[model samples]
Target chain A: MTTTQDRQSAGVEITPLTAPAQRTANTAFRGLSITAASLILVTLAAVATFLLVEAWPAITDASGELADKVSWIRPDEGQSLIEIAGYLIFGTVLISAIALLIATPLSIGIALFISHYAPRKLASGLGYLIDLLAAIPSVVYGLWGAIVLIPVLQPFYQWLADYLGWIPLFAPADDGTVSNTGRVALSAGIVLAIMVIPIITAVTREVFLQTPKLHEEAALAMGATRWEMVRMAVFPFGRSGIIGATMLGLGRALGETMAVYMILSVGLTYSFQILNAANHNTIASYIAGQFPEANSQGVSALIALGLALFVITLLVNMLARWIVSRRSEFSGAN
Target chain B: MSKRIDVNNLNVYYGGFLAVEDVSLSIEAKSVTAFIGPSGCGKSTFLRTLNRMHEVIPGARVEGEVLMDGVNLYDPQVDPVAVRRHVGMVFQRPNPFPTMSIEENVLAGVKLNSKRMSKSDSQDLVESSLRGANLWEEVKDRLDKPGSSLSGGQQQRLCIARAIAIKPDVLLMDEPCSALDPISTLAIEDLIQELKSEYTIVIVTHNMQQAARVSEKTAFFNIAGTGKPGKLIEMDDTTTIFSAPAEKATEDYISGRFG
Candidate 1:
């Protein structure tokens, strides 16, 4: 009878074992993955901490006075956080909301057309064209909006003021005249809509294309029309994905800097009149416009404004995630 | 509501490739007819053509006349959607819309046509359909639950309930039990026998025993080689097809000699 150690050595020689090399490689891969994941978390935490440190001066300077800190009704320049960014915050939300309202339906339609309605060759060509639009820089969009679209949309703005002035959103300015320049929140929103369409369409199209074949067939076999089939099968299946895509577009519109800065005639007034060119200013545009000329206190104030924007976007994304999770059970994507 | 089906020189094609060559057969009203064949034999394709469901696929077309009670379904004036309404289908794998509740799933076909029914009537219809599919006892208390919450076998019966709620003249099943467990398969087989009294049933099955057990008439399809279109080899009473087939291919296939 052979000893156990001698038998093991013989078995190892026969098997040609690479266990030692495999174990080393496996440990190294696990370590690398853990390091990469930790790096991301650490980087995010570092950024947040830096923002807080930069913004502390503004937050503390306005602690004693209610008027300078959080009051939207008054403007003061001496304190670091004077003139609460209420209008900037509201303008960002309103403009982005407008962009999403205009883009969501159109993006979903284009996505549906690409996935279902259009012929195969035409659909792929259209998809490539949409992706190309996404590849275009925001500055180009701004320049085009300022030069070409502003002038072209002047008459449409006049028509809205003339015919639909009873609606507060489309009403004329306080001076009883709509701005002929067309540099307004509506215009910026339209530009943002054009900017965000490709992203939403790409995402929604992917989700629509992923509708299971069996579910689609089930609808078809039930005598559903093409549109009805989309309602029953495609839309329900892609509901959460559509919501997620819309949220992504909303995020882009909220943080969009160059396009809004170049297009909108910036204003500091707290007003809800989107059609008024003299009453629009978003946080991103404010930052880009004021950063170059800002003193130390002003810089801290701007960082505070940026922090507010970061918080708002974080809240919006969290809300979107909650909605998606709530609907995941019915979505059947899993 | 059952109806006879008459096929005349049916040929199925996908894009430029022929999938099934010219074939013709008649199916009696209120009877069970099973198509038995090996894989890629186009039995499922032929079944889909009976209800105009094959046309849903891009570039999938059929050159044939599928007459249901003397009406040609392939006529240009006759809408495929209308054809599908009259001839419902059950797929191989159960696909109850996950977004819909069990009751809503049963009413899907009826609702797709935009037909208005009173709440009581709708509830009645749902109950009867589920009872018809032999699923009411298991699912009655949880009719509001998502259809996908059911087990695989129950989901298949729910699909059967959905199909029958439309009260179609004919029902097409594409290997409905192939994805089911042995016990579930037996349950569906029993349900198919009961369904034949109310609906003209056409099933495409790969299992020879299932074909013998559930079908009254049997049709066998065969292909000569790879890349060749499938053809109907023979069709006869199930007893005769399994006992003394007219074609050698059918006999060999039934006897497990060769596909």
Candidate 2:
């Protein structure tokens, strides 16, 4: 009912606007975004359903003893699924933990060096090199681990068993002779460490770089040395970020298949001796090794093991999220 | 513990670009001196050079002598860390370590120096430093709370407590009240009056009224034009500078003619 003059007096603009087209685009893009998001959930659901369906036979079967068919340790012929995955799960956790232990400090150090210590040019160059390392195919790492790293680390493993043999982890077996085959959990862990370093370093370097400049200046103004400034300002600010990065590395290490399979002399024992050759077999490697020739029961068993690995990784990532969220109240970025 | 600062022919540069030209001033011990100027006039840059904190920035350098208690702070043999320990700084915006507790924030400087203190001593220091910043009564019951939980004014006071905890001879505050509200600014102005009895204080302020209110001596900085280095135009008692500055530019700036 209002005239143009009335509208103008009401402080409305008279310009011709393309708002309808913008609205149409907004609605279309929103629909596309929602479809993209739903696709992820749908895919996850499909994978979970498929894994459950494929693994159903191993969960229960013809004679009620099929659950024992996927025995991880001493899987002769007839074992239940619940009892089957114990050794594989243990090996996966042990190797990943060892790898994380070795990688965490080194990755954090590299990240700090790249973020704080290096010159701008050198830092960017190093960052690019690390990104390149991450882009290398896992198969290449497998080949390198098998060919170069294993042969090179044999002497160091022997030295550990020689000098630090008093420690229970490094002690030789009852016969007092070490397994000299370079293929051991320790070697696999070291390889995994090398593989995971790039990812952890990249993530942590970004976190350290994002440290608020005011906080660093505060520490430096307080008479803190360079190292002390990093310890006080950089580390505290990056704690949750470091935890996240380590968890990412841990997830990759746990799910790694080819490199671990090729590097570790797969064994079925439930031993914790990392230095002993032919003493470990992670679920991913076990699945990759056996899936090619597996029958229906074997395939179902492997699927069941894979499902267990999926659950483990899920739990670990959830824990990392919980830790990060719990500490978010104190983190500066929050 | 307050010490006199004598800056002689100071020139500050960042990557070969002169930020501040030859300027000299003496700041008396146990008194408050304020630097007032427009933004980008290098007042804050010059303040940082007092504690050797200017060099912390990459490519930032200074050619000058900042003598405190007859010792050249810029001496090659002198460690910047030690120099900073003797002269503490509070930044414009409140920057308490977000992860630290209120009590921990107070003890941050001392802890950085790796000084071993007994539990009771640390507790005493925390209380005394907070008291010195005029924040003890407000924070006494919640010393274990995270420093970030405090209000803006309280956070600034906590930062002041942190700077004073190390028992530094001089305290440098860079626009310490620019980000604060009027009430918080008044609180800080009161605290500065109390602090001047114990520690030499150098404050850089953009508010002329604030400079007149809190400072005994005032230094006015000015720049010739864009891309030119800043220079000190006048230094005198606050009343003299506010009422009857000698330089035409100083009078023009103080009387709101031009920057």
Candidate 3:
């Protein structure tokens, strides 16, 4: 206030370059933007710190009753939190890997169909429907997976067990008794695959559409068929983009809880039998299913599981970022 | 493999609009012909029609016939893709596949079509094509580098190499040097001289001096007004067209008069 009055009394502004009034406005905006940007970093740090604090007791075995009635979650005496986390991660990685394997190719094919094959009007309508698919609530997907998808996949699982039992991953039971229900990891994986398709497809379609026209024309001028041109120009240019999109889908798949929790009959066995009803458990679905009935220590242990999941997803996203940035080095020159 | 092209009453259209109307000209084999005109005069469109490339545009089509070695290119039995395989093109801008290295970019036409060749054959073809484009010496040590890593001039030459690797009979250049600097333009002009010994060359250029220098024969195209179809005003030996043009529009365009 004093400074303003003093400057007014001087009867002149700093007329050299930047105006004093504009500088003040600039400073205020700079502060506002800085605070807005720092809020994300600060919130991230706070969440990480809180997770560490809460999970420390379970990790160090300070919290008694870590192994309560739910021995499946905490395991036997003195089993380190790392081992529990490893089991959860294994399950999480297994189901999402299956989902990714199923989703990525399907998404790429669908993206290509929309971008290159379909008529323009039909393509737009199809794209809109896919985007709408992406917007459907996860809880709704959970319900659909439980009531609709699981029952539909039961016959398929039995057929796999009947003919393809030699593949250890698809084996139903040693006694050859076919499970009546489809509440298995394989079913959960397919549900997750369906969930991530729209997300991966939408991203890859955008990237494919952004392919440089000059390159496409070059290929066509050289007598390439449409498929060949897409192979030469579209696929190569959109490689990193597809990988990044798949990673985003993977991130969502790994952290997805409601869909998996509803579809899966969870158990903590180390069996790789995906067709079996009670073999493995993704960390997220496990947490969701067990959190409500958990003791204080049990909840702490679950948070530790969440921390492990957080680290894995963070690594996935970072790997995606690195891949995208690496492509830009050569990408920008063109 | 060089072949003469005879275009008869060619009319190019984009949907309902005629772009270039009733252009009939003979392009000699193993010689360079230049098409020169102002912007939007359809010189580039007429050039693309020789190789059926104008049809690549949606709703853009051609009427009448373009004959190469007595085969009508616009015939119902003629496949456009097969036509393009024999008649390659270089655009106004340099476009090398960014994802491919120099060696892959050189072999892109063959490799993308899944053609199988032994190691030695591919190595020889890459060498010969790059040499033909006058780019082998500068890029020999870095065949593994991405094509996008090359300078603008070198990338254009790489594109030329890719086009010729398919062994097309007629090569069409649409303002190939417009995007290049003067020195690079000279380099390409010199290249067009050597390339014409084995391939029929047709170029569309906005620069009169470039057309005068590089072409054996020159064709001038003109439009009456905007949205009107362009017509070929005159075509003659490069020396005669520049010295004593027959058409008033040709003389006017050549002498800095109203075109």
Candidate 4:
């Protein structure tokens, strides 16, 4: 009789929480997640819009003190609009080209060492070491390049001046000081190259390791040597991945500011000799160096340059993503 | 086809553990020899030893000698790389190189070794190899497509063609049909039968029926005890092994009573 009463009581009992309450709690959590994500998206859009709005005055005004104060806004001496566009556009391209030339081959070697040559136990630890290099503060890289890399490179500069100076790219001044001017675009490029190496190497190593074992075995079975197997199977299989890695590294190199500014002593002028630091400035460093002190008109011009960087990086990243997606179709499963 | 592989007193070790022990077998020229056993029986391990491919796994080593055409494969003077060149392999899964076109994959070994040949000669070789594997017509119009873009059966066939391109004396297959569908398995089985006429074929399979169907000679392997080395129970002509195996263990395994 007592057990029966207990069972009846249990069946008829009410809970402290209802289904609606649980539903409300879950809905609130989901709504909060969406709000947080939306906030980040809206914030970025607002910043871009603000930059555009602030730069409008500089874009409209021309041939005055206000225009002179804004570096990107100021037309070249007796220059048309077309020439101004060319100079701005070419500055970004030039920096990217110089950085890629120094970075691509070195990164490939690093990737090969990490993926194929390193001992299995050692590879993971070494890969993490490379990743740690990537995480170093950009300012720290700038300081190191300015204080250490510049002075150490001076002798090489003087030797090049003595031997290969007739080649304009390698030419040195009469003093042979090898200061920021000597370090110029070439020095900035080297520094930027070092900065992007970790990124490219880490990515390429992963891609190379993903090559199918059967493909490699097939090559080896065909009387191919180890190096031959890599040439026939690994290299061809990893081509798209390598290209994508190079583009990502190139993007980072192109937009780098603090290190380039620290290594390159330059005004707004562009020139043929990359070693002539006094002549060349990239869009990023130009904006970074001048924007802090600029008035409304000056601020607007700087924002325009930033906008150009945004558009360029966006297009490059999209193209890289597309290429990777296409490669995935073949690389899936077996 | 002109040479034979003789594995004498062979034992395979992965690290310190003995995976296969005292496996002695002779594979003749232009014939199909199949190693049949249950899972984890080291049939594949014994097969890899014949081609010196067991070394590919870190810490795995083989004791005794594998004599290929009267040359000791493990001799201090012999190069394993040269051994691999002569004895081609096909994996359980089809693995065509992802970035290479169909034609390029067929020419990969020659191109990498920089073996100079006229364009017509290369073209002829590619066509013949592809036809040999029964894949020429299916892929003829799509030679420029990536090798990985093919279906599983087609990819496996492409791999077979790649193996044949080097003109290897022996072809080693490890569960080659395990990853394929029924139709694909039949296609590969037919190819194997045809392949045995030109190249010596050694296969490791879990399917006793496949061993009976495809192999001229059959080897039965079984683990001795728990955590112990696998041993060859019996080996003989395919019909004899199935009909009247000398060892009780071989009869038990073949009858599906025990493994």
Candidate 5:
């Protein structure tokens, strides 16, 4: 028999092993992580493959300069990928800007009432009611714009031309009917704003509700009135979150296809007035309308337009995420 | 300046539920009065009522009068904003506004409420308030840093500075040291002692030792059980309550029995 002192000096290692239960749990977690990661990779690959195949014709050699593949200078009518790319880029930016103009203030007001001012028992109910607006299908919105929204806006566009026509943005035709003659950029913008309002308001209200209680309390303790406290505490704290929410709405507006397609009639001619809805064409609407009638080369051009819209929205959302991440530090009591 | 608060049979309610039942107490001018009790015992509720903050919570209602310097705080014509302007509160957690710089946080009260203050006067008030809270030296060089960047102890001091910058006659503190380290607690305790020379101070605290350390007078509160209203069991000189005779409940609470 070995003495305890002899065993201690023997330099043999005895491993106090991890329990089998823990080892099995670890193995399960490792397997899950690998599986989840591969799923994401596979989905990304599928999207990339789709975009590359669809966009190949636009980049094919048919132009004078390599760089001309991305330019709108040469509208070959049927085979110009570069020209289609430029139009989609312009449409995405124009739609996003117009939608943001209307959505920002509307969303902030809706969020304010839902998060801070509305009666306690009614706040959530009212919020849900508003969110129901977002759930209506996009096609329904397109139909509504064509029948109701366009007709209602017709008189306003005439009034805008009569009174505010001095301004370049309103200097379009006085007749604002929804016929092919009346479809314009303004109608597409209004449709996009209405479509995005619920998303932005719902997101912003949730963000504002998550503001730390103590910060509001501190503002109250300082004798700031409800509105004053909101102006100082709530607005400052919620600014970046609101910006992110608005950008998300902007992304939705950029990709909005049905409403803009149904409401706007692109006559292949560009003009200055935003109210010239009959002549306006957005990236999504242009692609949707032209794709079915398009030859193989035209289909490629439209797909390339779709790619440009995709890239624009992607860039905006990434910028929004960066802003939102910077804002997370403000959520704490500190 | 010295000012007194007379709380006359004050009752607080959240809708139909009674929170604090019939608390009547007088806070002497220019002294620190500690309201000592266990968790959810209405000490904070009672403190909030003094500043009209109970009304800030939806459906919260107060009955009876809180007369500060002879004016009833609950009078219909009286503005709650005006009442809060005169009576500033610091909460249990240190909450410095994240958007504001350290100096701006200190001056938030005056900047938001006051119609005007001379540029020099505003600067002087910020410096003096920070000095009063004993945080001036530590933060003077970094006044432009965000208030959230401060250490926990420094943030609490910054809140104290914010409360003082408004120049309120009454300063209400709800568990101001509960979240701080002992060293920070001692610092706040020292500041409270100094503050009582100029402002009427009412503090709600769970630490009996803290009550014993800082206050001239102590109000002991107890709640029998869940759903039971909290009651003020005893109010007396700190020395008498801790060392001498009082209600048995007060003694039990002080001696570390079930509170």
Candidate 6:
């Protein structure tokens, strides 16, 4: 009461609800924050527009003068830009798919081991070690894959072709031999798998750690063994999170360039013999290897290939969001 | 299926600190027993020791004998997991597995162990368990919906159904209705009255009225000060404890004269 009377005596009045406040630190921070956020969207739109404008002629003018000069893309057959993109899309997807299949289960195992099995004193240290794998440069991985990993895998590839030659995937090329050099799609995919494990493991470890305590107790109180309890509560709770993490890894693998280009013995073969040098090549590596020697038309074709990769990555991201969101709505804690 | 419990020289510890010290008590089979105490008195801790649930927390251990039907649950040959199976538990909050449908939630105790059940047998079991918890009428049609879609009261009852589905000999409740409304508490109290005829029911509660209303026997626990272990102070019939407690501290706590 004294304060109110003092305020009235001092001729102070409450501000109206609609009255605007004077400029303050809050307004400045909010302005800067919104600008930074919107800048990302604006930059994304600008890049997409630029790619679309630059790649239009190469994509539309299939038999024009520029498309004629866009050699090294089936020069004898005169394949259009869309056809070449479609061909490269297969290799990009095949490599990332292999990476996803190998990385997803390994990441899940490492995450669970870190989150549930490791002792409290050692778990944090193991987690930091896993995250450190992501910090290694891709070029270093490329060098290691080419120099050290290839010789170790060459005998193994030869053994697979010798023992499992009847299977079409391990069957030799039409020239009648496997890659004694081990610079095959299988090795490139394995290298990509090693590179993306940290990404998937990081997201999945945090999700597994966030499994609700009450739910875990509820399962354990039911006499569930430790693994059973994890299967019952932790796995279901982290399912959508696992899917999202795998998609992130897949996106990273799809756009990877230096390691794949450095390690791959680039050749196009439709037989899908993964243990051979003459196999499909990813769009990123194709562009990376060819960009320096490319003309104006060749550059546009490469940008168009990049646009295809961007579309594929966008689709995978959308699919991840759809699955995660749909799962949360259907059965997650409403 | 109810069985009596005999606890002798029970001491619960978290790491090196004793939480509940040297308690001895016998609970009658087929009746409701309530443990009442001030906050941090370890009533809930002692309750967890009954089913070996406290060991889920690392370094939490108990030194004592918890005998159910003349068998020592703490014996080296006995598995804690088997003990929990025979002694079911319900927590304060209603925690039906959110990812499961109502029917699946009821059968989780059996299914999560990977035991096989025929389709018809599981259906019958679901009906009987939900009926046993008095929730069949409300949720009969939507057993396919997620367990989390229910109201708080309904979810608590679903947890009760889940607990009873395993056909345990004893049921341990740790402040099961503390997070519920008065009407829901009454509903649970009435359910407890119904359940005590079939299973040995031990509950820890803060509300004296709830203890008086639902339990036949009451035990009072107290702590002298912070950092001191909680001890069981008195045990008697509910009427005797409320109206004429033998211990002065019990009388003070019952009569609202507590410090």
Q: Please write out the lDDT profile of model 3 over residues A120-208, one tens digit for every residue.
A: 89999999999998999888898999898888889988999989988988876978845577888888899899999999999999999
Pick out the ten consecutive residues of candidate 1 chain B with the lowest summed lDDT: B38-47
Q: Model 5 off-target regions past 4 Å?
A: A1-26, A60-81, A173-182, A267-272, A325-334, B114-121
Across B203-255, the per-residue lDDT of candidate 3 in tens digits comes to 99988999999999999999999989999998999999999999888999988
Candidate lDDT values, in order: 0.90, 0.91, 0.89, 0.80, 0.83, 0.90
Comparing 1 with 5 on lDDT, the higher-scoring candidate is 1
What value does DockQ give for candidate 5? 0.61
Candidate 6, lDDT over the whole model:
0.90
Query: What is candidate 2's lDDT per residue for A1-334, written digit by digit as tens?
Result: 9998999999998866755454778899999999999999999999999999998887666565554443342335544456558878999999999999999999999999999999999999989998899998888998998899888888887888889988877777677656777888988899899999999999999999999999999999999999999988999999999999999999999999999988888886678778887778899999999888777777988998999999999999999999988867788764
Q: Write the per-residue lDDT of candidate 1 for residues A116-146, one digit (tens) a residue.
A: 9999999999999999989999999999999
For residue A299, model 2's alpha carbon misses the true position, in angstroms, by: 1.0
Model 4, docking class? medium
Candidate 4 residues A212-258, lDDT tens each? 77777766666677777778778877888888899989889878988
| Pairwise lDDT winner, candidates 2 and 6 | 2
Off by over 4 Å in 3: A1-33, A62-65, A68-81, A322-329, A332-334
Model 2 residue runs over 4 Å out of place are A1-22, A62-79
TM-score of chain B of each: 0.99, 0.99, 0.98, 0.96, 0.98, 0.98
* Model 5 per-residue lDDT at A315: 86
lDDT tens digits, residues A186-240, model 6? 8889999999999999999999999999999999998988898898899989989
- Over 4 Å off in model 1, which ranges? A1-21, A63-83
What DockQ values do the models have?
Answer: 0.80, 0.86, 0.60, 0.51, 0.61, 0.70
Model 2 has a DockQ score of 0.86
Write out the backbone clash pairs for model 3: none
Tens digit per residue, CA lDDT, model 2, B9-67:
99999998999999899999999999988788999999999998998889998887989
For candidate 6, what is the total of clashing residue pairs?
A: 0
A156-229, model 5: which lDDT tens digit per residue?
88778778888877885655322334467777788889889999999899888987788888999889999888
Report iRMS (Å) of candidate 5: 2.1
